[model samples]
Target: MILDIYKDAFEYSAKNLVTLFVLGIFCLFSFLLIPIFLITGYNYRVINTAVHGVINGKDPLPDFDDLISMFIDGLKVVIVQIPYLLVPFVIFVIFGIISGQLTGILSNAIMIIGCLITLAAIIAACLMSQMGICHMAYNDGSFSKAFALSEIKEVIDEIGWSQCIATYLGLIIITLVISFVVTLIIAIIFAIFGVSGAALGADAGGIFGLGLVINSLVSMFIVGPYLSIFNSRSVGLLYTMQI
Candidate 1:
């Protein structure tokens, strides 16, 4: 059953991944040069809606369109709210010192504990925002309700700790692996010419850096769809587990 779950998860990821990317790229490139993309203006909302829709087995188009419109509507809201995310991050940094203190004091135990708490806080913050947006996209919920402290259990319970950590971790790992392999190959090519890739304009590091940013979106493209489907199954699984 676990194997089946794993297979279903990965296969589900692959199919949806392709669709999300193609659609995302189409919309993204369509507005590439415009200033709006910088704000991630419409592009963000569209992608968010589509992603959530796909996960819930709804029509992705509505989500995509809603995302676009939401971006336009929420511009001011975004400007106001974006900076607040930093607070928890700052908390995370402060706690990180405490977490670090674990090593010398308790062989890193306290530090590890502090770090975990900080990470949990950071995750909680992001999760809250995600649920807020997803709930709005899914059900016309208000942004306030979305961000309310109450809905977090629903998000974490539905998504599961393993899946959330794995999803974020997987995307990071895959992106780094791809970026590394590509850079190494590029470096070797440059090395044959007695040129240092980083020293020359042909900097793999820059390419990797650029790719990391691009790849985050590409991850949404590549892995996000599968996540939606897997999440759908997870919802059902949650019901079963509860029973």
Candidate 2:
């Protein structure tokens, strides 16, 4: 059954749209596998900022100064753990350009094959990061608790490989389903206005690409909090079933 608090997700997101938008900006810029990392990172910040602001009963608008400080603070914490991430976000742009040049010299298939490897690496990194953070928050594991190799291995091991794969696959399908539904809804409206969705960039094809990005953001706003909160709860329930 869906929880009553699901409504709060939207309220929470709307309250921090500026922060989310800013976070989305940073995330869009930092990419190997889209802006998922930045999206996740931004949520943590938004939640922290929004929750605190509301607790004090105030309006929340994370503008330039607000965002700058947030970025710097986030940078410092990141440098303490993954120091390499802090060394200029500009590297992603440079590396992407260099990778593109290499891809031009290679066949599309070969280029894609190479990209697949990098993409897989990034997805694994992001997912593991998300999982570890979830553990730290939900399980009261220390911020550094996840860094211990054995501790991390246990979390991964607790998720049987087959189940983990299936969960990953399920995430993919859920994302796609949301994307498709949103696209179709947008396209129909655009169509009624005598604007071909393709021209408006809401057509099935255009929207699918756009949908992935939009849906990712939407999912982050709507479903992410639940997933983040209940992930360990679900795992605990499963563990209980086994015992």
Candidate 3:
């Protein structure tokens, strides 16, 4: 089942090189805000498409043809995500304040405990938000459905919590492994080109800066979009199990 999910996501993402490149370009300009929404909306569309099962003659991967509607759907996605993330954010902030006011062993203990709690909260939030996003997609982009906690819980129940957590962790592990390899290769390339050692030379500052720029562009334009699409598609397919 897991292999099928990943295989489908890979095929779906690679089905149209032009579409993927366009998404990568949008990711490159995501700082402009609208592009991010468009990307998010596209992910939503992927989920919606997967849930309904792609119709004959329809593309499994959605096109970027409907910018206005995509932008609005993206807004709903972001809105659904905020509160789930806020739980961990608030917990971290509170712990920071309390830890700052204390001293000695008690402070260290509190800090350690807080860190653990915050990490747990973060994991929980991520799991919930992933489901929430899918729930919204399942309901045809209903913003309210995203926060329908009971409904979300019911879906999780149907999927089984163990399977949900395992799937989420699998995605994270795969992403991390790919990211580590990519970063290592980039580092080696820069090292061979003397970019890594450029910072030590007075005249090589520009070279070092150029390396940074190149790395950022690669991440933003290629890795970012590919992973985003893969993850969204995988999650969307996973959601199909509950239905």
Candidate 4:
């Protein structure tokens, strides 16, 4: 299922390279991360589509169309996500308030526990939120559906907790590898150009700076979208199995 998810994502990207490229460019601009969220929401919509197709025994990679709707859906996704994301921050704030009153070992112990709790909450949020996003997509873009704890639990149960964690961890590892390779290539290209520019009496610093911008554009435009598509498909596929 994982292999198929990646294969489908690659095939979809290959077929819709121009669309992905545009989205990537928008992502590079940042626009206060609004564009990033919209693109992410669109990816969620794609995952939702893929999930339904799998449930119906016909897997399909959703088309990248309907920009307005995708943007709205992405907005809804942000709405669904903010509270969950705040969990760890809230934890830290509470601990931070109490820490000032303590001293020595007691303070250190509280800090340690606080850090652990915050980390655990973050990990939980990360895993649950992915499933929550899937739920939102699966339930016809209903934002409330994402917060439906029981439904989320059912999907996890179907997917098996251990397997779900393993799948996500594996995806993280794969993502890191891809990121490293992309960054390395970008760095190498920049170094080569910087050296050539220096030999030609051009400013090495300016050339290197330009390389950084180019690297950002390439990573954002290419790697970012591809990974998003791949991950959306993987999550959607996992959700489809239990449905």
| Number of residue pairs clashing in candidate 3, backbone atoms closer than 3 angstroms, sequence gap of 3 or more or interchain | 0
**lDDT per residue, candidate 4, 1-243, as tens digits?**
666655665565545667668778768666777676678767777778777776334444555677778778887777777888899989988887787689999988888889899988887787788889888888887788899988898899988888787778877887889888998898898899889999999999998898899888777878888887777777777787687
- Which lDDT tens digits does candidate 2 get at residues 1-243? 112123333243455444545544555466653344434434444334332332223434334445444444344335333532322333444455566766455645555555665565554554455444444433343556435546545666765545544555554564466556765775465345434565666555655555456556754544444343223232222222111
Tens-digit lDDT string for candidate 3 (1-243): 777777777677767767777888988788999999999998888878876663122446787886999999888888888999999999988988899899998888888889999999998898889889888888877788888999989988998888888888888987888777886788677665675355555445565566677777777766777788888887877777788
Tell me the lDDT of model 4 at 77: 74
Model 3, position 127: C-alpha lDDT score: 84
Candidate 1 has its poorest 10 consecutive residues by lDDT at 234-243
Worst 10 residues of 3 by lDDT: 51-60
Please provide, for model 1 over 44-74, each residue's C-alpha lDDT reduced to its tens digit, 9 standing for 90 to 100: 3443444343333443332334455545545
The segments of candidate 2 whose C-alpha lies over 4 angstroms from its true place after superposition are 1-116, 139-141, 195-243
Leading candidate by TM-score? 4
lDDT of 4 at 115: 89
Alpha carbon lDDT of each predicted model: 0.48, 0.44, 0.81, 0.78
Indicate whether candidate 3 or candidate 4 has the larger lDDT.
3
Once fitted onto the true fold, the runs of candidate 1 whose alpha carbons sit more than 4 angstroms away are 1-39, 46-52, 55-84, 90-116, 193-243
What residue pairs are clashing in model 3? none
| Estimated TM-score for each candidate | 0.49, 0.42, 0.84, 0.85
Off by over 4 Å in 4: 1-11, 32-34, 55-61, 196-203
